[model samples]
Target: MDPMHRMEQLVTELNQHNYQYYTMDQPQISDKEYDLLYDELVTLEQESGMVLPDSPTQRVGGELLKGFTPHRHLSSLWSLDKAQNIEQLRNWNTRVLKLVNDYNTKNPDNPLPEPGYVIELKFDGLTLNLTYTNGELVQASTRGNGTVGEGILAQVRTIKSVPLKIPYTGGTIEVQGEGIMNLSVLNRYNETAAEPLKNARNAAAGALRNLNPKTTAERRLNAYFYNVGYSDDIQFANHQEMMDFLRENRFKVNPSITYFREFDDVMEQLAAIQESRGQLDYLIDGAVIKITDLRTREALGYTDKFPRWAVAYKFEAEETTTVLNSVVWNVGRTGKVTPLARVEPVELAGVTVQNCTLNNVGDIERKNLKFALGTRVFIRRSNDVIPEILGKVTEESDGEEIVFPEQCPACGFPLEQRGAHLFCNNKLACKPQTVARISHFASRDAMDIETFSEKTAIQLYDELNVREPADLYTLQFDDLVKLERFGEKKANNLIAALEQSKDRDLASFLYSLGIPNTGKSTTRMLADHYRDLHAIMNATAEELVELPDVGGIVAESIVTFFADPFTQAAIEKMLNLGVKAQAPEAPAAVVEDSFFSGKTVVLTGTLHQLTREEATQRLEALGAKVSGSVSKKTDLVIAGEKAGSKLTKAHDLGIPTIEDEDELVRLLNQQG
Candidate 1:
């Protein structure tokens, strides 16, 4: 077979599997099988230089969205003409056949017979127009007026299912697709949301519009390319060919699409989509039917509102009813409060849901929900964790009205409202807050006290009057042995772990401080600036602002934490109790003299040559900052045996990979 044709076949196969894997979480091929095909496609693409849009190589996400910009689409993305029933669909088919018949009568050479129609699921999602410049995804936009849209390149970059770059086709092209929020994603998001989205479409739109690309990426949205909105170098003979073209380029086109010469076949396909809609990850409100022949569609051009060649067949709403029992409130680790609806256990989309989130007090009030416990509420579930109460059937109920509490359930701290969010004011004194802080302090990312657990912290709190991080260093073996289940060995282990934590890295020490707004990464940045703990403690908010990613709020948080009398006293007591704060290790050399200098290197898998701590220290000593994962900023990856996705991701970003610790040592020494 010709290389181009082979490439096309390979593209279709790989993209189908990608859709099954990324979007559907069901891979048709094994990892080895997929890798073999992928390697073959890469080789073929290098040889031919004509990569299809649907190639699986495109899904390596890299670009970071800064903000949405104004973009003028190459072609107008028209709204489809609508049809309600089989009778209306038949009428449209009749009109299309009549147009084809007339065109055949007028032109002698290209006389047309009855045209076939292409049918695909009309995904109920945000319309996104993706523009490619020589196969690289340059911009993604929302359909504003068909001609112009807001470019959502940043937000789109975070969507894992979409390809960042495809094999080069000759010129610019615009692939129109739908950005769909999975029903499951929306349901999960709503559990902690201040204002829950009504449905999948709204949720998708919200994610796309989000200014922070990181948040958008967290939403795990999927996209399906359905049409070629514009193309400068490529032209399709028909809609089916266009679908074929999209697949060849590695774009995720709808798998259920079909071409039917007869009107009855089209109806069957539509019915099949409707029947299996419940099983789909994405939401679809209708079926789209279009004249397969591109020339015929052109002749039957546009109406004022929608395309005359295509029609949308909308489905009836999938709604049902349930009972609202009681509402429960949950406090998160961050102390933010949210409300949940404890409903009568009912099955929805095959899962029995007993509770659904009411979001917040504001959400409940805005919706005018008076459906107290035992009220016959109109509940509807759409692939959600909990069914939503559509509205109340009755105006009144015998149950008491749900009200927001003034005090925290776990601790007697007064609840304070900051905009829509509610927080426990007594941060250090609160039980949940203390447990959360201590647990975070001893976490693997902080002091790395693996033997210490939250349950153990609570036990210590109950018996030993352990109040803060400083109190942890003051624990005696006699005190531990007095607690339930704590033997001599357990007590010794706890003490040993605490001793080990005393000499933790400067970054870890900073992170474990339990300072508000300071996380693992932020602590690392702070350590990079101030090598000594004393220097950092003395720094003002103005000085903190000079560091990378440190905003006014974060600066203030740092200054305020160190300035606090209680915090200062706690640190003094901890230092006296053998909790020594280690200073930052000296770098091997300055950036100009060292190969490893100012580089972000990731260490993965098991190393026989050097321990993880030894390797990290060696690299840091050479001015290289070691990170846990791969990103665009990663300079190199030192992989040992069984190195996982971090190594793969480094390769995808075109970063260098080194095996064993010898090469790393050689590079550092040679450069130095």
Candidate 2:
């Protein structure tokens, strides 16, 4: 075959496979197979001294440029207004409705239809603007200052999902989308990486903004096209039509786009998406809600900075950058010494994060943060967890070194390094460790000893030498009454609470033991599986690893915790002091013939008679799958007072609803 002809055929075939694998999530060929063809094409291009402009091999990246050139966007990329809460979203909707109504009253003949909405995921990545002229990709840049941006055509071309040449050849057009580094890709990269990238957002943004195109290609980034900001030969009637056009031209459009006729339904879907945010492969900080009709959007027009027709409903931010001020080593209940970084006060996920966890010395080294003090670092807080310092801003650090402690801060014991962590083996002597263990044992999730506080633990430890959880069961009323702020009533109440905690279930008792590497879920699973405390204590690491979500580390931790002589003596002492440690009865089988059996049910708003939690439990008892939002798949909706978007959506979708309190009560009673 002629080299040119074969090259064309190879480019077409390889590009098709790339589209199928990356954009469509379906791979028709294996990686080895794809590589053989790619290598052949590379050889042919080199031999022939000719390369096609649209060749898949172009994504390999070219020479490093000195600097980026300024590229003025054909049409300004406007920012969307943000809504932090549902009320803010509702207010934006009200304003959009008023604008449409006002326009309709002015122009009666060609008035816009009732305003509908299109929902898209607000991707947490760098915004990219690509311009194509005569069907060929000519330029790509960031969404800088809305109008002008730094040109990054070479960097954008390296993204295999981006189309090199489009079928539309009538005129020039500019498409807008997000350039993202998928979470899975980031993980894989970090596994072999010497200095790991902090987050996906920063990885994508930094790669694109880099002067070296090879660095961008090495990240193996991806793009998802969403809008045609400027088009000379085409016009879209609505968002759906524009999306269809993008799809037809081989653009990588995200499949999660949905159209809704009612604004309330949009809100419901946004809430639903937010609840399942973890399921996505990429990071999405929010959802974008836009007017579906082009006419309505045009009528609403733009503000000084944002478009009035669209708003981004921002979810709680999970990640942000902050400066690390200092590092403090603290002893945990297990006598493990961990580094806690005190960062510059920054707002993250609605909380002021001043302190972040560094995990251990191994993590600090792996993240290239051994000398990251007094430098900017990316901090992350998710699901209300304590913030974690991911890494430094740059691979090479100019900051001061974070010195690992040679001795325990509290007990002044020589620290021992054990698997990336420092430990103070003086468990009985360390005051902080002992105090933490006692407090954790009496916590609400553990023994549920009411009116107990950390302050109480401190006082007991300082005055009465309450060293271990077993000591709590041995405490006398006279001892407590002699402590500061412990009146007769308070002392009596403490004794009564301690006595009541003796009957706690085996799961709670196990959690209160402060077993290493075990959480509530793991303890609960162990309790359910064994049904006896002795069985769990005697189980080997090999046997424990068979349980769900249990790994080698957790299994070994559990076995080691039980093997200790001190732990065995503590358990025996507690048992002798009237601690029952009873296991719960096996759960009853789910009712298969109830009204809510095998159904998807949604509960919305405030139930005057029963709390939402109580209603959810009742529904689940009848074998219903409780969901956060309403959709066509929803079998029934229990709408209470002030039920807003979810109830409205259920009604719109023609799903059955129980709005009356009496009807809801009757159904729940019937199930029982």
Candidate 3:
């Protein structure tokens, strides 16, 4: 096939899949299949020396520029005046109508017609202005400081959802839109990350501002174009018609947008969106209602900051004021100490909020938050979100200033300070630590203990003198019954779970050990090298350092953990309790000379016909080092459907890549 023909076919297929997975939430092709096609296109482009302007290969992320260059809009972009409620919205309409009536009286001969409103969901995201010349996407900029914005044309191109060329053939056009992160994608990203992101707004902002096009591509950021900023030769009678024209030309229009003949219709739509906010995949903080008639909008004119033709009905502030009664310290897994503020029960947003996070010591000091026996404070929650403390009391009182404890509240041991964090020194003796560790040990990724739960472990710990995880094996039915929540049946079930954990593979058992800086991936690496817990414990630091992916810090942490007498005792006890800690039979070896041999492979996105574990095992058999994330040393990334930011990084680094499982297989087979 000709390069142009092939390019067109590839783009169509890729765009179709993008719409399926991103917009429609239904993906037809497996990630691996999509990658196969993508890789072919990339290879063809390189071999033929033909780079199509709209090729997907052209969009890869790179480092952010030293700074953003400002670009002024041809037509001034304006903000919208805010209305919080129905009455406020009605008042705005009335005020606008009165102005229109006054302007008509001055003319006397021609009276303005009743204006229609264009109501659309006000997407909670960063606003972007896109300029297209002769149907080619030209300039993309952020709404920086209102007047001018940082130019992000390079970054914007990487976003697959942002069309490189508009569907229309010819026009000089400017469109207003929101660059947003879909809620589902945001949640999925958070779930896979070591530290989950705070919210969608921040994620979207971070993605858009990224200097690398590859990074933007991984984020799967989507755009919805709403308004025509400046256009010539295209005439629309109303705002609705303009939106229809944009949509017809393959521009993504906000699906929640509604045309209202009467103000009551606008109010109804707004109410519907508000009530169904949770059902929608993206966050909508409010609704934007505008005069639909283009002539009416022009007559309404502008304010200094906002367009007089439109009003944003902001969601009512879901915040309430309350008093801070006390602040308490809580310990978490990984041993980070956090402070929680206990405030008087106050209705905020839609729920009653009694507590808010104080984060770390820095937050407390910065807020200068004083929670004596009783202190006045304010709390705010919007859209069923977690309530936050807005501020604290203005007046000073006789109550003592709250101090962070120097010792673990649960174990009464002195704490260790590392950077900004304070941690309990009692690694095993701390009740919270013990419970958390045991729970982690029995998690599906760790020991795979089918029946053990945190609740059951806590019950055994507090009531039955089950001080350590090893003690779980000795638990009796009567001992469980002595606890408040557990009955005879539950006790037996827990014992069964303990028995099942004994047969888990060495890697999971090692992970279940809960050594500092040791996670599931690292645990697997150690197991693959040493074969058993006994071998790992007996291995010297030098021997441990030789393992793939085990760095100096990780090696040191492992050595420290094994050298500890308490940890040694715990392991001895666990062995005595009949917990098996040995690797299963290694998979049949693939050809040693395969490209995967000794090379680090990072897998992202959904794989077809192979589970993640299966793929990892296959790569390991070929002597490859399979890893969880992309780093400087990653040799190849096997990208699949909805492949993330790591895939983009791999491309930017010019790393060798395989698009699909079949291609991966073929490469290995070639080496064989």
Candidate 4:
């Protein structure tokens, strides 16, 4: 069969199966068969250089959104207070009991007794609230800030189990639940997903919160209600009654709901839940214990951030024991060297963790870590954060002794200790440092050179002597094809991509320089301040620090980077190869400054025609302050597709909003 034909067949077949499983709750193909097809399609897409947007392999939240409407929550969704261990939980119980005692003492005529607790599994997923009116599903929203949320009603309609219309028409009803991915679904999805969702929480969050409803529909997300947030017509005596009411309505409620009269009983149930957690279809980071009586919950009231009525008992991080094979230092693009543990692969939280972070030399010494060649070690995964070594499993050491390297591994140079970080200081001499710099320079977030994978980066350096980003621009087609696995078609595509990257904007070019601590957003801020590459290169530390987000350390690094002779030569070389960054035009005198001027504005989701950089420039040009977050100080917020937590936050704060990029431009023109 022709490759493109097979790719189309696979995409069609996969989409059908995904729809059946996720949307329809009926899968025709087995998990094994789906994986085979999905993997083949991805390989073909990569080889053919024709990755379809709708392909199953391409669904990790895209450029945030190009707009979002606010959904006001019917009932306030209060965050739970957390207790990390049993001792902390006991302390919380004491405090709660004392609060009740004090209340009873004050009102002896109508004294209240100890409240019974309802124990439920705390699902590691995005919280969703669904509302039904007259037996018909009316609205759905995320737990944005508890009071108001971004309405994801369209995406909510995709969940198979969530009834569009409930059987019992008990007036206006609001159900609260978690949008979680089944462990089985997560495993299958990871096998072929372009970028794996990491865990159930992220999978659910990414699916429901994404700008694309079709993507959410394809996640097969499971929703299990825990409580009724609000009900205008139906009222329950206790939390258990609410659960019963939901189940009676054919609404999916967590079956694990249990009532406990004593604190000890709650603790016992929490232990049991922890022991049997592996049997469940989703991940639970903690167990929620809430007061069973609704009246008691109201009486207990809420703190500033959390409810006094309930507490979440956090589970310990998932960990596994493995032998530490060796410890090696890895050189980053900034030339900072950090110790990396090479451990024997051990499965922790369903993923095999072979390498874990040792943090820094101070962390290593403080923890009394000795990464002896054959020592048993403990590795842990908390939430979805990087796997970390949590001290040694045993004190005994049998193999090679752990020793800090005096010289750089890639280039023989004396390692310089600066604060906590060890630097190579080799500059042009370090092969790994140079290669990593080139790789970072060509990365998608930087120059967006899609063809420049780490493997390809190494091949360019070793095979073709392409040491720097500039060297890539000078590569000949004949020279590339001679290298193993570099087909004429692949080489031509890579060369074309490289040629196109030369015309990238100033921010991208600045970010591609691999300046330490100066990320994409920071680079844009610098670009806006300086306006051009030449101006940025000549900037002093004092001038660099004056820009937004540019701290002292970042300023020093930028200044030092440009001061280096090799860095100067590299930029000059790239410029000669037609790497263009058009200098910003002088600002026209403002005829009349609008309300947007001198205001802090936030943008969320993806923008159309305008990248975040482009939006930042246009907004800054109007004398508006573009902030990454939404706060009380924020004057306005522009929402785009799949606007997540930030957009909800903006609504909750009652800030002025712009619907889209066109509206924002109009505002700058003082027309809106």
Best by the TM-score measure: 2
What's the CA error at residue 535 for candidate 3, in Å? 3.0
lDDT order, best first, reads: 2, 4, 1, 3
- Summing lDDT over every window of 10 consecutive residues in candidate 2, give the lowest-scoring window: 645-654
lDDT of each residue in 1-672, candidate 2, tens digit only: 888999999999998998777776557798999999999999999999999999998897899999999999999999889998999999999999888888989999989899889999999999999999999999999999989999999999999989998889989999999999987799789777876889999899999999889999999998988999999979999999999999899888876788999877887899777765654667889999999988788889999999999999999878889999999999988899999999999998778999999888878889988888889998887645688888887777789999999999999999999988899999988999999999999998899899999899999999998999899888999999998899999999999999999999998899999888888768877987899999999999999999977999999999999999999999999999999997866667778888889999998878999877568767777888787766556788988886766775565345788999888888778853
Model 3: residue 424 alpha-carbon error in angstroms:
2.2
The lDDT for every candidate, in the order shown, is 0.77, 0.88, 0.76, 0.77
Q: Over 4 Å off in model 2, which ranges?
A: 1-108, 112-124, 130-174, 182-192, 209-225, 230-234, 240-292, 298-324, 343-353, 363-401, 586-672
Candidate 1 lDDT over residue span 1-672, tens digit each: 999888988887776776557644446688899999999999999988876754655444334556668899888889888898889988988888887778888997977656888888888889989988987788889999888899888777667667666665689988888999977687677666655565677668887887766667667788888898888878788887888788677677766677898888888878776755665656788889988888888888888888888999987654445677788777765677778788777766556777776767766654456446667665666533355664455555555677788888768678998876678867667777677777877898788885899998888777888878788988888889878989999999999999999888788889888677877668877786788888999998889998877899999999998998988998889889877777655664545457777889899878887777677767777778888767666787998876655664565345788975677667756646
Task: Output the better candidate (3/4) by TM-score.
Answer: 3
- Tell me which of candidates 2 and 3 scores higher on TM-score: 2
- Report the C-alpha lDDT of model 4 over 486-541, residue by residue, as the tens digit: 99998899989988888788888998888877777788777766787888889999
**Cα-lDDT of candidate 1:** 0.77
Extract clashing residue pairs from model 2: none
Worst 10 residues of 1 by lDDT: 56-65
Q: Which stretches of candidate 4 lie above 4 Å from their native place?
A: 1-284, 287-325, 344-346, 371-379, 392-401, 584-610, 614-623, 629-671
RMSD of every candidate to native, in Å, equals: 16.5, 7.7, 12.6, 24.9
After TM-score superposition, the amount by which residue 198's alpha carbon in candidate 2 deviates from its true location, in angstroms, is 4.4
How close to the true structure is residue 191 of candidate 4, measured as C-alpha lDDT? 51
